[model samples]
Target: MTNETKIPNTRWWRILPATVLVYIVANIDRANISFAMAGGMMEDLGLDAVAIGMAIGIFFWGYLLLQVPGGHLAERKSAKHFIAAMIVIWGGCATICGFISTSFEFNVVRFILGIAEGGIFPAILVIISHWFPPAERARANSIFLLSFPLSAIISGPISGWLIATWGWREMFIIEGVASIALIFLWMPLIADRPSKAKWLSAEERNWIESELAAEAAAKKAAAATNKSATKTSYRELVFDINLWKMVAVYFLICCAFYVLSFWLPTIIKDILKADIGMVGWLSALPNIAAALGIVFFGRMADKSQNRRKYCIIPYVCVGLCIIASVFTASYSGWLSFAFLCLCGFFWLSGHPVLWTIVAETFQPEVAGGARGAINALGNLSGFFAPMLLGYMIQNYSRDAGMYIFAVLVFLAAVIVWSMPKNAETKAAVEKTREHVAATTNAHA
Candidate 1:
């Protein structure tokens, strides 16, 4: 491995805390609601399963609307300021939840909170694409995203304890305060571009910048053979069949992951018939497994540089586990839990793999826009998945919801299987040249 690809660099040390720790705090803000639901937010608001689902999912609606704008904005200008502003807004919205008594009030703030958070991940992707070369990016994306499971590992029990002792309202208000405080850490530590990261040694900075420049040059060279590529607008990311294929797969992945994220505690509690606090700790096991998977799969992807295989494996695992969990839960609750833990383990791998494919496909200049487009579209699953599960649980059975999840994962696997490989991406670009030639001749 080259020096630049090594993980012992100053950049990982600097960027990991900004992305991972702050995201840990952000996850706390978003996820505390699950604890709150368990803590009696549902009873207080008189919300049924469907209402809970919509409340959980509506945030994505607002989140979805601004993703393109938020992503493109970060690409055009400064992610540092854009992310800072979003944290503050989401923090405020989380705080508002503590005071909200009505369902309307609750959903409204959650929706606004979604709008605030919509850009942050896309902006971070922009930042990563700039600072880390592709060789290190899967590792970077893995370690950075490892924070999601880490958040669950840490937040699950803490939220449970808080809800059990104090109440759900206090949990929201306190976590919101924590979210606001993290922005202070974010602003000082995060630099939008490598040149601004003065903490790095001069040599380190030069290496990162030069490596990224070389990758950009390579992309341009690959595109130059495609006559239409010269005229290819960044807007073309929207229409790229390959890009959309990735997005659809990610959507299914989100559906499975979020079901566990938003609903696992509730499901586990039904199986165990135990204390909420115990459920908190029990629910944490899957997240711990997921955290390990994120790092392990990310590093493996970086080392192997076999992006599509890694992506496909996780969805297949998730689908199998979804089917297995139905049988396991019928016999043993612990067996069902073990299946979910495995599901979480493989489920977390797809994300880092997906982002690595994107980083390898698009340049940093438009990388945020591409990430935003994919996430905006992909993340719509976050909205529908929860709502559908909620509907299924209320009308049919939780097993019925699992069936839907399995179906989604099956479709996701199909899409990932069809996605073009790296060499094929080049071929796809070359095909655009042929299309341009044929059109030119016809018009002439």
Candidate 2:
């Protein structure tokens, strides 16, 4: 029997669901601020739009602190332990948001919250790399990333109802507490790698280890011949042009993404002239569309193994939809909402595929640090985008901010389409294709 046949696909059942749940709680904690702003936190705190924006944006500043260290620790020490500790820290900070009365207090808590949550993303990516081979990586990434939109889907209406019935403070406390409670499940279920996982059968564990070891050896061999691959040090990685290109691409994508995330509820409320509860439900529609699109496009990218095509296509679509939504907003609210859903569909779908490209470009030895650097730099947009949009909305018009996002997203597509394919990336892609083919033939 083939080794593939001997191994059960237990990683999917064991790992994906646990990680999804952890991230769901994490995202909800981070995003619940939007509902609070809409619900009356601004009035309660006596804060203006700019102040609120600062409060939201400050989180990213703190978020920048731990990303590289977190990823490195996850890779070198243990993803399972690092992530568990972060969950506790973020949960405590999230709960603290409930008791703050002033904008300054809110901003301080949010910053700490950002720092607490920042490392979780790259750490999770590191965990995913440990568990899944290249053949399944994109799909695995998409499934795990489902936490993004799924959190919005689940949180939107629920948070709305919680805020509507009990107020935003209660909503924050409840969700924060729930996030802390998740640590129990996380600790027991997660293992840093397959060999450490007690739940996997001996045969399954052996297969996973062998496949990963082979892939690692191939990468080592490729690095022997490639100068770019030889430069794995932090200083060397920071100076790498290809790494910065990815950073720029991710930064532009994030500029558009954070605007969509932080302002979508307000935009929906303005269009519908609806109550907070109705706005919550309406906001969820775009994310529902995003969830479906992520699943569809993730599978397509995996099947085709053309990461650049998938990433660029979705980016183009996202840009067009954002621009279209702006023009349509003045004519018809429902039409504008439809365009927003389209924007969400494309915006969120590209992320998993883009990360797949990152995984393929960097060897596992440096993957954690590389991912940390990219995510940290790219997520700086989380600070800039919301603050810029809020200023634009206050001084100029909402459409102006959206136009900027569209332009930035379009630029991201150009970068992805134009990025140079290096020897290491080419070799990785060829290896992945061969691995996928072998696995397929084995199953057949």
Q: Pick the candidate with the highest TM-score.
A: 2
User: What TM-score would every model get versus the actual structure?
Assistant: 0.92, 0.94
Backbone collisions counted per model: 0, 0
RMSD in order of candidates: 6.6, 2.9
lDDT per residue (tens digit) for residues 1-444 in model 1: 124444348887888778888778877787778888888999999999999989999888988977878888888888899989888888999988999989999999999999888888888888888787766789889988988999998988899998888999998988888888877799889998888877878778766765665566556766644322232457666567766787888888898888879988898888778689998998888889898888888888877777888888888888998788777888998888888888889878879989988877765566677789888988888799999988888889989889889889988888888866666434443454445446556876
What tens-digit string does per-residue lDDT give for candidate 2 at 91-122? Answer: 99999999998888998999999999989999
In candidate 1, how many Å is residue 145 off?
0.4
Candidate 1: Cα lDDT at 132: 78
Q: Give candidate 1 regions above 4 Å deviation.
A: 5-8, 224-232, 424-444
lDDT of each: 0.81, 0.86
Question: Per-residue lDDT for 182 in model 2?
Answer: 93
Model 2, runs deviating above 4 Å: 1-6, 224-227, 422-444
